[model samples]
Target: MVDRKLFAGHAVRRMRRRAGLTQAAMAEALGVSASYLNLIERNQRPLTAGLMLRLAEVYDFDARTLSAGEPGGGADAIRRRLADPIFADLEIDRAELEEWLSGAPGGAEAFARAYDRGGAGTAASDAPDPGTVVRREIERWRNHFADLDTAAEGLADELRQQAGDLFGAMAERLRVKHQLSIRILPLEVLPDVRVRLDLHARQLQLSETLDPPSRVFALARQLALLEARGEIDALVRGGAFTDRAAERLYRRHLTGYYAAAVMMPYARFLRACEATGYDLELIRRRFGASAEQVAHRLTTLSRVGARGLPFLMLRTDRAGQVSKRFAGASGSPLVEGPGLCPLLDTFAVFQRPDERIVQLVELEDGSRWFTSSRCVGPAGGWSGAVRARFAVTLGLAAEAAGVLAAARGLDLTGGATPIGAGCRACTRADCPQRSAPPAGRTLLLNDRETGVSPFGFAGD
Candidate 1:
C-alpha cells in the first residue's frame, strides 16, 4: 500500500464479507480500529505479516496468499459491466471500480447481469469502443509510477556496486548472471522478434535490424523482466490492473522504466542532465539511450530530494493518437484524454522527419508553452523497420521553459496557434480542421446560410 509494499486487501475484505460480518465486528476480530480495517479493505493500509498471521487464526485459509495478496479477479466482470453505453460519459477510475467490485462483487455482478438482461438501452452500436475503453483506463494515470522508480533505482544501485564504472553495464551484469551468449541475427532471420532468449542454449538472439540504443534497450528490458520478477509482482499488485491487457502494459512499462534507470542511473543521469542544460543529444551520448528514452527518463525525474525540472513528455503518431503522456510536476494537465488537435507541433513533425520542430504555443485559456517535436525514427520510414514519422512531443510551460537547452535563444514574440485537446470536446468552432461540431453545441444552420468556418457554433 505504501508505494512498493506487498499486501492483498481485496482478499481480506472479500473473506470478511462472505462471513457476513460488519466493519466494527471485523475490525474487533482483527484487533484493529474500524478505520484501520477500512484502510486495509481499501488497500490504503498494508496487510502486514502480523495481520496475515492473525487472519490465518481468524479464518481457515492459508495466510501465504496475503504475502503477495491475491488481486481481486473482478476486473473482467466489472469491465463487461462498464461496457454498457450508459457509463460512457462517466470518467471512472478502474482502481475505484475495482474497490467497488471487491467490496460488493455480488452486487456488481448482479448489476452487470441485469444490464446484460437489457436494463441498458438497446443498440449495441452505441456501446463505447472497446479500444477507447482500454485507452481511457491507461490514460487515467499520469504515466509514471514511483514504485517502478524505487525498484529500478535499487536494481541500478546493485549493478553499480557489482559492475563498477561502465556505460551499459547492466547488460553486462545480466549476461554474466544468465550465462547468455549474445547473437545478432540477420534482419530477415528474426524479422518480428527484436530480442529472443533461448533457455536451453542460454543464447540471447537479437535482430541486427535494431539500432544500438534499441538493442541495448531490448537487452536491459529482458534483464529487468527476468531479474525484477519479485519487484514486478509487487508493482503489479500495486498497479490495480483492471484487466490482463492493463497488467501486460504495466509489466512492459515497468521493464522499460527499469531498463532506462539501468541505462541512466538516476544520480549520474540527473547530474549530467543539469550539467548539459538537459541537452538530449549530449546526454544521449553520455548515456547509451535513445532520444525517446532520454525524454522518458526526463519525465521520471520525480524522485524525492534529488529531483530535476518537471517536464511534460508525450508521444503521438501523425494521427494525433497518444502513445505515452506525462503531466509533469506542475500538476497541469498539459493534454487530456485523446485526439490531439491537428495543429499541434507533434503531428507537424511528421512532414519533415529530418527536422525537430520547436514552437511557442498558446492555449485557448491564454497559457503559453514552448514545445519541441522530433521524429523518433528509422529516417525514411525504412520500409522494414520502425516508422520514421512517429514523433515525440516534449514541452514545458513558458514560465519554466528555461530548463530546455534550446530555450536560451527561443523567440517568444510570435503568435501562438489556437488549439484544442481534441475536436469533439473542443469549443473552438472557427477552425477548418473541425471534423465535427462540439459535443453539446448546436450548429447555426438556419434559413440563412452557413458561417465561414467548417463547423459554426450558435455563440460567437
Candidate 2:
C-alpha cells in the first residue's frame, strides 16, 4: 500500500513559530532550501517523511501531532458541521473543503465557531456547555498530557523504590509527605461517596464497598493530589476554561489521569502491551487494574516516538447513554457524541456480559476500525441496590488490527460491519438499527412499501 503524503503546512508553521525560528533558520536547521521550506509551509508541497524525521531529530517535534488530525475546528469538523440541513443546498465538495481548509484555516475555524454559536445572530453571552468545553479541550490534546505522564512516572518510580506494592507505597507516601492517614470506612458511613479527603482530620476516607483495584485507584488519586498538584494545576490553567465548572471538571480528570499513570507507568505499560500483543486481560492482571482502567491507559500511550496504536474509547450504560469518551489519535467522530450507532458492538456486548466482542467496522467516511468491547462494573457491587452495568469499548484504525490479540483469526479486509457516527449525522438509509432519520435528508414515506429500516430517507 502506498502512503499518503502529509499536507500539514499549518502544523509545520506552528512548530517553527513555537520554536521561535524564522523560516530561513528552520530551513537551514532542517537541511533544506529556504524556497523548498517556504513551499512546504505554504501547502504547495507535501511534508516528506525525511523532512519530518529531520524536524523530529533537530527540534524534538512529535509526528503524532500531525496524525492527530486538524486541530480543534479544522476541516473535518467544518465538513461534519456542513452536513446539517441548513447547508444542504450549498453542495460543497470534499476536495473543495480540504483546499479551503489548507489555504485559509483561520477562516474555516471562524465559520465553525459561528455555526457552533447557532449562527452570527446568537448572543455572545451564550457560553458553550461546560462539558462540551472540557471534552473539546481533552480532544485538542489527544487525551495525552506528556508533562503529567512524566511527573506520574517519576513518582511511580520513587514509590516502587519505597515499597513492593503500589497501593501500599502510595498510602505510605501520603502518610509521610502530606501527614494524611488512610482510612477505609463502611458504605453506610459514607453512603453516597466513594472517596473523600478530610482536611480537618488529615485523613483520606474510602468506602469499604470498593474492590481492591478501586481502593488502589482512590489512594493513587489522593497521591496525585498531594504529589502532582503542581502538574495538575498547570494543565488546568492551560485549559483556559471560562467556566468554573469546566475548570474543576478538567482538574478532576487530570488527577484521574495522573493516578492511572502512577498505577501503570508509561514505559513499563507500553512494553507490556507490545509484549502481550495489546492484551487487555493480561495487562490488567499485571498492573492490578480493572478492565476499564486498562482501556483508559491504552489511550494515553501517545508519547512521541514510543507511541502505541492510537485508540479511541467509549463507555456506555445499558440504556445507551454515553458517559465517557476519549478520542485519542484516531479522532473519529463516532466516539465524540452520545448519539452513537446502535449497531455498534459496544451495545452488543451487553447481551453476553462474560464475553468480549471484537469486530471490524467501517464508518461512513470509508475508514475502517477494529473495535473490542466488554461489560464492566456492577456499580451496586452485590449490595442488592441498583446494579448499573456499562460497556467499555476500545477502537483503533483497522490497519493496526493485526497487533491486537482480540482481532486474532478475524479477516481485516472485507465483511466489515458498516456503521455510522450516529443516527443524526449518519447517512446510511438502510440500517435497520437506525433510531432516527439523518438530519439533512428528506424522509421517505410510502404506504405501498415497508422496508427494513423504520425511517427511510432520500440519498444525498
Count of backbone clashes, every candidate in sequence: 0, 0
TM-score for model 1? 0.67
Candidate 2 matches the true fold with a TM-score of 0.88
With candidate 2 superimposed using the best TM-score fit, by how many Å does residue 96's alpha carbon deviate from the native?
3.7
lDDT of 1: 0.65
The lDDT for every candidate, in the order shown, is: 0.65, 0.80
lDDT of 1 at 106: 60
Q: Positional deviation of 52 in candidate 1, in angstroms?
A: 29
**Highest-lDDT candidate:** 2
**Residues 1-460, candidate 2, lDDT per residue (tens digit)?**
1133567777888788898999999999889999998888777788887888988899886676674445444454555566655675688987888777777767775675555444456565664566666776676577888888989899899989998998888888888888999999887888888788899999999887888889999998888887788988987887766568889989989999999999999999999999999999999999999999999998887775677878889999988888888877665667754387877889888789999999889988799999999999833254577777899999988887787888888989878889987787787777888888877788999899899899988887
Question: Candidate 1, residues 332-405: lDDT per residue as tens digits?
Answer: 34555346777777877777877778888776656787888888864121355455456888877777776578
Report residue 135 deviation for candidate 2 (angstroms): 0.8
Clashes of 1: 0
